[model samples]
Structure formats: C-alpha cells, structure tokens
Target: MTATAVNTTAVDLEQPLQDVESCLNLLGEALHRRDSAAIELHAASLHLALAQAIEQFTAAARNGTVPASLRTRLMQAGGRVAAQRESLARATAALDRAIDVLMPGEPTGLYGASGKNERKSAFGGSIQA
Candidate 1:
C-alpha cells in the first residue's frame, strides 16, 4: 500500500477510537452528576462514536487483523462499556427493589379490595362496568 493509504487508514482508526474514548469520558461525567439531559446527550454521542469505531474495526478485520496498539485500545474501550453496563444493571436492580418495598405485591385499583370483590348475591348488584 502507498504511504497515503496507510496514513488514511491510521486516521480512520485513530479518530473513531478517540471519539469513542471522548464520548465515554463525557458520559462518565454526566453519570457521576446524575444529569439526565447530559446523560442522554452523551449516551447518544457514545452510541454514534462506538458505531463508527465498530464499522472501522470491522472493515479493518475483513482486510486483516487490526494493528495491535489499536486493538488494545478497542479492547479497553469495550471493557469500559461492559463495566458501565454492569453498574447500570446493579442500579436498575436496586431501583426495582425499592419499588417493591414501596408498593408490595397487593393488587391495585378499586375492584381489588379484599371483601368488596366477593359477590353478596348474583341479582343484588351487577358490578360489571
């Protein structure tokens, strides 16, 4: 390959990888602050950057194994993404537990009251609405 092709390939890999890293940094900050708006924005950015990186990496792989240094960076980024996912899963589970504590397994709505649901007589009143 020509020097220009090599340089272009390097640029393609480097920029997307850097964008992914940058987006992750911003996302981490937003998460730390618990800022919903910032989180949403950064999450979208991260998604785009990660997608671009995946495209570039996939193309590179089709041609040949990605160069080692870039592969290491990609692996590290993937690890960070996994760690973030695990943390979110834990948080989601805790939120679910809290909801359960606040509102147990009891039925909701007016019809679900214990004694009220039992029919006194078939003709006395038609509760069907």
Candidate 2:
C-alpha cells in the first residue's frame, strides 16, 4: 500500500496583517495630533502596507482557503478603515456647513450691473410689462 502526504504549509499572513494594523494605528495617531508631516508619512506607509496585505491575501486565497483567524483580523482592520472614513466624512460635512454659515454669499436675483435690484427677463430682453 502506498500513501501520499499533503503539503499543509500555509502562507504566513501574520506579518503582513500586523504591518497593516501598525500603519493604521500610526496614521490615526498622526491625524489625532494634527501633525501634517507625520500624517503624510504615515499615510504613505499605510497605503503601502495595505497594498502588500491585499496582494498576500489574494495570493493565499488563490492557493487555498485562508485561515479563519486571519480572515477575522482582516475584517477587523477593514472595519476600522470604514469607521475612520465615516468619521472623516462627518467632520468634513460639519466644517463645510460652518464655513457656509460664516461666509455668506450674494443671492443670484435680478440685479443690474450697478448693484441695483431690477426686474429682468429670462433672456437678455427686458421683462417690463
């Protein structure tokens, strides 16, 4: 009787996943501190780490089923990313609203070139009826 052994070696995703998580944490810290330089650096690092993690994960998936623990960690990292995005969106909207309130704009009503409110028409013609 002949028996065949299967290669149970799995891809090492722990380091790649950890690198991404570390980058995310550093980026968060930079953002919190409002350090423009650190933010830029950490943002670049985070981008690279995320790309590497994706490549590793994709390759692993192609080869075989990725372990559940690694998948859970990846999902957690994705959740953090989503949360950060949503928070930034909310803050941006609030800031935009604040700016709009502070800096008022002139209405687009019918006004003459000399800054006089006058009744105009749809086209260049007058609407004096």
Candidate 3:
C-alpha cells in the first residue's frame, strides 16, 4: 500500500472542534481529487482524532456545560462522514457485481458416457469431449 504523510503535530487537541473541521476540509479535497492513498491515511487519522476529541469533551462536560456551537459542528462532521461511508459502500458493491459478471468463476459440469466432463467453445465447437 502507498503511504501518505500527514502532519499530526499540526492538529490542536485543545481546539478539537476546529481541528476536526480542518481535517474534514482536507478529506473533502482528497476525495474530490480521487486520491485514494491520501484519503485512506486521512480517514484513519481523522477517526483517531475524533475519538480522542470526543473522550476529552465528554470528560470536560462533567465539569460544565459544553458550548452549543461545538456540539453542532461535531454533529455535522459525523453526518458528513456517515454519508460518505454509505456512498463508498454502494460504489464498492456495484464494482464487485461488475467484476463478477466480467470474470466469472469456474463452470460446473457432469461426466458423460466417456467418463469425462465435456466442455464447449463459444464458436459451437467441442473444446474437450
């Protein structure tokens, strides 16, 4: 697999919301450009960052109320990721079906009176008998 470098040090854990927003923007650009390697790397980094942010915020919320705007932004980011995941799944399923049709698996057959399984060609000729 190809590796894509990301500057994780640039992500501010203190400003989790903004960090997520920045990562989402980068992810959007990567997706738009169809950069699969970058996308995979970003997606993993984003997941880890988001999880850490959620845990930190959850702990902080026990002390005081979390801001409404921050919660809203997190919700929006989650929705976007969910939509992208669904789209990717659909595309993957379509591609799998196309591949199955184009390159089918081995054919099954029965042995004839000659104790051999016969095979035929597309041109109406016996390939094996």
Pairs of residues clashing in candidate 3: none
The alpha-carbon root-mean-square deviation between model 1 and the true structure, to one decimal in Å, is 4.7
Worst 10 residues of 2 by lDDT: 1-10
Best prediction by lDDT: 1
lDDT, residue 80, model 1: 92
Prediction 3 global C-alpha lDDT: 0.70
Q: Higher lDDT: candidate 1 or 3?
A: 1
lDDT of 3 at 84: 74
Q: How close to the true structure is residue 58 of candidate 2, measured as C-alpha lDDT?
A: 89
Q: TM-score for candidate 3, please give it.
A: 0.68
Q: In model 2, what lDDT does residue 62 have? A: 80
Off by over 4 Å in 3: 1-14, 108-129
- Candidate 2 regions exceeding 4 Å error are 1-11, 111-129
Q: What is the C-alpha lDDT of each candidate?
A: 0.84, 0.78, 0.70
Clashing pairs in 2: none
Ranking of candidates on TM-score, top first: 1, 2, 3
What is the C-alpha lDDT profile of model 3 across 1-129, one tens digit per residue? 111111222122247777677777777788778889988987887887788778866865664555556667778988888877787788789989999999986665666567776566688876655
